[model samples]
Every structure is written in C-alpha cells, then in structure tokens.
Target: MIVETSPENFQVWVHSSRALSLEEKRMWLERMRSDPAAHPKNRWGRCPGFRNTKEKHRSPTGRFPLARLIWIDWDSQADIPLLVPESKPSLLSHPSRRGSVCHPADPCRYHFKKDNESTTDFAYALSLARRGFSDDQIRQRILSERTDWSNHKGEKESKTTSIAPSVVSNR
Candidate 1:
C-alpha cells in the first residue's frame, strides 16, 4: 500500500506473510529510503482525510495538502525471505566476492568503511542539501542513517545545522 502524505512524498507499507522484527523492519525502511527515525512499529501513517500540516507543504492559496491513499493491493504479499540481509556483509564487501549483488559495472563504493563513516555521512548530507532537501530532512537523514551521528546527539544537531551555510555558499 502507498499513501501520499504530501506532494511527491509517499509512505509505503508492505503486507508480508509473517511479522518482521524491529531490525528487519528497519532494513526494509532503509531499502525503501524511508526516514529511519519514523520506522518504529508504533509510528502511525497519515490519515487519508487529514491535512499535511508542514509549513512547506501548505498550498499557495492558504490551504495544506491533503493526505490521501495512492494505491493498495490487499491480495498481494511481499516475499519475506528476500528482505533479510546476509549474516556477513564483509564477505560481499570485496569486489571479487560481491557476486551479483554489487554489479561489476557499477559497484557501491561506500560498502565497508566503518572508520570513515563520519566523513561519508558529511558528504551524504552535503549531497542531500545540494539536491534541495530541507534542513529538517537533512537532519533526520543524518540522525537516522549516519552511525557516527547517532552516537553523538549534541554534535549531530550542530553538524546538521552547519550544512546550510555550505549549501548556500556552494550555490
């Protein structure tokens, strides 16, 4: 099922054969490019008739965008087993051992570099900012997706805020 919470923004839900664990759900959310901070089981989807109250989503005519159902498939089921990650990602990190997961023509360069995660996170945040993501969106992505940022609350907030100046100057 897919719900449009605002223009060009959607939340997707998959009905699977078995219930997924918290970590499993997190992985699925990451794969779907969802805000990981909102991936908790207790998180509720926008109600169909409610307005998306975010200031940026407000229409020019002084109204907010309405959240609505985009699509649904009650009869369809997600393949649960395919969603699970391999037990050892390091085995696949090496280019030769990547098999078919990481295409030979286009390999994922960010695969197993835990030591440089902070640098990578900063670069990722910069990319998002360059692509016109709002400050809040960049903050959420940094907090949720960056391993280094998650461990340092004060530092994370400040770092996200600092991205705005760089974004403006670069443009």
Candidate 2:
C-alpha cells in the first residue's frame, strides 16, 4: 500500500501472510529506499485525512496538506526475498564481545546502549511529530507502545508537545 502522507511525501507498506524476521525487514526497508532512520518496529503510517501541518507543506492559501491514500495494489502477490547463508565468524572474532555488557541471554544485544525503552518511545513520538500527527495522536501512540507511561500522568502529553518544536527546528 502507498499513502501520500503529505503533498509529496509517501509511505509504503507491504502486506504479507508470513511475517518477516527483523533482519529480513531491515533488508527490505533498505531495498525499498526507505528513510534510513526508520526502524522496523515502527510499522504504523500517517493517518489519512489528517492535516500535515509542517510549515514547509503549508500552501499560500494558508492551509496544510492532507495525508491521503494514493494507491494500493491489492492483487500483487510479492514476497520477501530469501537471504543466502554467509560464512559464520567465530565468537572470538566479534568485537563487542570483548568488553561489552551484552550476553547471549540479552535480547537487546542488537541495539545500542542509547536505545532504551524511553529513547525508543521518544524517537517514535518524534517521527510522528515530524509527520504532522496531532499531539493527541502522538500521545496515544506513545502510551499504547509504552504502557508504563500511563502511570506518569501527563508525561506523554508533555513529551509529545516538546517534540513539535524540535521537529520544526530540525527541518
């Protein structure tokens, strides 16, 4: 599915019966020339009909662009490509294993030290903010992903608001 999330910005999604593994998803995203900062876990796209309020998208008519569904190829039956096995490296050949805290049992070994739940949530919220999501929408998404935030009343709202300026400045 291809959605026009702004005047010219688009997001594409591939629906498949078989779920792609993390590596496979990353490979597919790369193949598709997606945003480099986009993570495989951030699967949701901008909601259609919502106004894209980025100043750059604002028209001379004093209105923002609305996100809309551009196209959908429902009949396409494409599948993710299969990856060939590469020669394995010995455990000793791994660089991080030398002194890092990551262990075989640590599921987060694939991520960097800066990629904790809070940081991930913030990044997700920031992405939404950049895409012109309303504060309520961003807050709802952050709270849904990080249920622990519900205990901290208003934190999600504050964070979502904070990201709006950052998103503007970033451009």
Candidate 3:
C-alpha cells in the first residue's frame, strides 16, 4: 500500500493521497517550509535535501515542482527538496520494512527510520519527560547516554566509588 516516489514525484503522490485535498496539500507544504522540526537542523540526519524556497521550476526530473514553487514563494528560506527514490525492487514485496513499528499518527514515528539515532534520542527524551524529568535533566541524560563512557578509562577510574572510599580515592 505504500507507494514510493521521488522528490520529483512528490506532488503526484500528494495529489494521489486519498485523505488529502488540494488545499491540505498546499497547507502541508507551507507548514513544512516554516517548521524547523519538520525540516530539521541536520540534512542527512533527518529528511535530507528538502529545500524551502520560492522557485517555480522543475528539477529536470518533474520531481517536487510544487516544492520548488513553494521555495520560490517563500523567498527560498526553507530546507532543500529531498530526493526520495521510487520503491526499490527488494522493498516492493515487503512494504512494512521501511521504518519503525510506531504509527504515523505518532510524532515519534513521523519521520520513522529516516534518522534512527535521532528518533531514539527523541524517544528517550520523551520517556524521560513523561517520567517527570526536566528538559535539562533529559538533555543531560541523552548526552550522557550518547557518550562512550566505557572508553573513557580515566573518567571511570575517577568516578568509581567504593565501600572503602579512601582506597579508591587514593588511586
């Protein structure tokens, strides 16, 4: 049921969506241009090459021509256009293997496996927040989690607390 399309074909896909109207498609494109969360800071780490601009031209491949128009309309302030390829032969048979198991309705699954590490970070942060952790605490936790603590021998040696504190402290 998942029909894949390139940036060139994005408009076609959007128009073909049974759930979305032409106005809705326009609105979604507008939101995507202004929203940093939608566009993201990292290109390759998130949805890559999606440009928000106002250029009313095609990429010679007919991909996302409307996106180019949007970019031009916005005065070219949005993210670059993403070049998503058509469904691969291998994936044609298994449509569900593209990303995580979470529903598209969930913010955590919005971009899916596009950025697995970032998604993990977001999920961890969300879990910590739900558990009553403050933003700073959650950030610290994620940063700590991402750090390679096992490789930092000096840090480990310094922080290790023992029942006989004096013995370990002296080392």
lDDT of 2 by residue, 25-142 (tens): 8777787788997778866768778888889988999999889988888777566567654556556554431233333332221232234556665656555554556677767665
Question: Which has the greatest TM-score?
Answer: 2
What are the per-residue Cα lDDT tens digits for candidate 1 across 70-168? 899999887787565668656543443212343234212253234566666665555555545567776776666555534556565567547654765
Give the distance in Å from residue 30's predicted Cα in candidate 2 to where it truly belongs. 1.9
Q: Please report, as a residue range, the 10-residue window in candidate 1 with the lowest summed lDDT.
A: 98-107
What's the candidate order when arranged by decreasing TM-score?
2, 1, 3
Q: Please list all clashing residue pairs in model 1, or write none if there are none.
A: none
**Weakest lDDT window of 10 consecutive positions for candidate 2:** 104-113
lDDT of 3 by residue, 99-118 (tens): 33333332332322334455
Worst 10 residues of 3 by lDDT: 155-164
In terms of lDDT, which candidate is strongest?
Answer: 1
How accurate locally, in lDDT, is each candidate? 0.66, 0.64, 0.38
